[model samples]
Target: MRIAELGRRTGVPVPTIKYYLREGLLPPGERTSPNQARYGEEHVRRLRLVRAMVDVGGLSIAAVGEVFAALADQDQEERGLVRALSTVEVAVTPVPEHEDAEAAAQARAFLERQGWRSDEDEPALRALVGVLGTAREVGHDRFWELLDGYARLCGPLAEADLDYATDGPGGWLEREEALERVVVGTVLGDAALAAVRRLARKQAARRRFGNPRADCGTEGSAEGGSEGPAADGATAERP
Candidate 1:
């Protein structure tokens, strides 16, 4: 195939394909003449994978390079390849997986049945299910719960992303910004959420007990057996 046809097939521009070839993300095409070159299925597949890494997965060029090298490494296990491809599929596909779609459908119904208005999150939910499926196969369901808690934030976060994605010069630029929003925002929001919860807990303590050290000696003790603010000997012994 020609470069134009390659770009058309990959949804990448012709110049971008050239740049990818230069960057070693895609291999050089076979030279048919001094100025003529022909890309084959390997080039197409590599280009698609490259596009998936940068465009959908939102990986930095350097990061994508590392991942590509890892994929090429013979030492990596099949599961590593599977996980990498799973990530690429999740990033590339427009919708969530069928298994995740079913799970999210059931979850949405469960929510509606409980009188909660949950916007459908088939893609996000399906992605979660896929992650969980992989996680379960590895015997790590607790990690799935941790990821679920993070996925819980996607609705509100996606709304924020929609705000930026819909604003300003609506073209590839805007679309690019939106994809960055989804990727970067997930990392930022998770960290922000954790900080907010910590701060909120401190603020709530101030209101309820009027002390930064309220939990120091609470009746129930701190959550998960964390030591309260009270020094062990500060409080009198109880009968």
Candidate 2:
């Protein structure tokens, strides 16, 4: 197939596809002529993977490049691939000035309690510290109380994720394919899980609060009702 056909099949525009090629995100196609190149199914697959990482996973070009480099490295061991995947899986935002030493200590302590081996310089650990610090700064210090419950939930999920990655089909997959699956799965699975969590939260809120109508009280009168003051300083009275 040609570049045009590859773009059409992948629903990606030609210029964007060309941009990916220029960025080294997509592999070069086979040269058919001086000005023509022929792409194959692999190109199609790669393009889709690139789109998922950039558009859905929200990875920057640099991050995507790093991920691809790791994926393409024939000498990378499984442990190296996991570390690479971890780096791309989380977004490392710039840390604000005036760090909260307490939150950082708390995060370290929590990690230690969990018996998880993490380095202080790891991006994920740094990100966690930043989050914890910000949570405290925003007066949500008690939010850390949920750590234990969240960790419990994460333990099983992480185990299941490893199980799927390692024990697929017969017993263990080819190293290259396994690495690719882990990268793609980690990227796409995060988005899928977030959406599911949001949906579940919506359902839980509806069940607990009985929807907007219940929260706003019966039709209009605020007398003896649970409806709070409206934003405009008006009482919600019964119709």
Q: List the residue pairs that clash in candidate 1.
A: 216-228, 216-229, 216-230
Question: lDDT tens string, model 2, 63-107?
Answer: 888888866764655675576567556442344455578988988
The C-alpha lDDT values of all candidates are 0.55, 0.75
The CA lDDT at 227 in model 2 is: 44
Highest-TM-score candidate = 2
Clashes of each: 3, 5
lDDT string, candidate 1, 134-159, tens digits: 66567774553354454466556656
TM-scores, all candidates, are 0.35, 0.81
Off by over 4 Å in 1: 75-239
- Global Cα RMSD, each model: 14.6, 6.3
Which candidate should be chosen as best, given lDDT against the real structure?
2
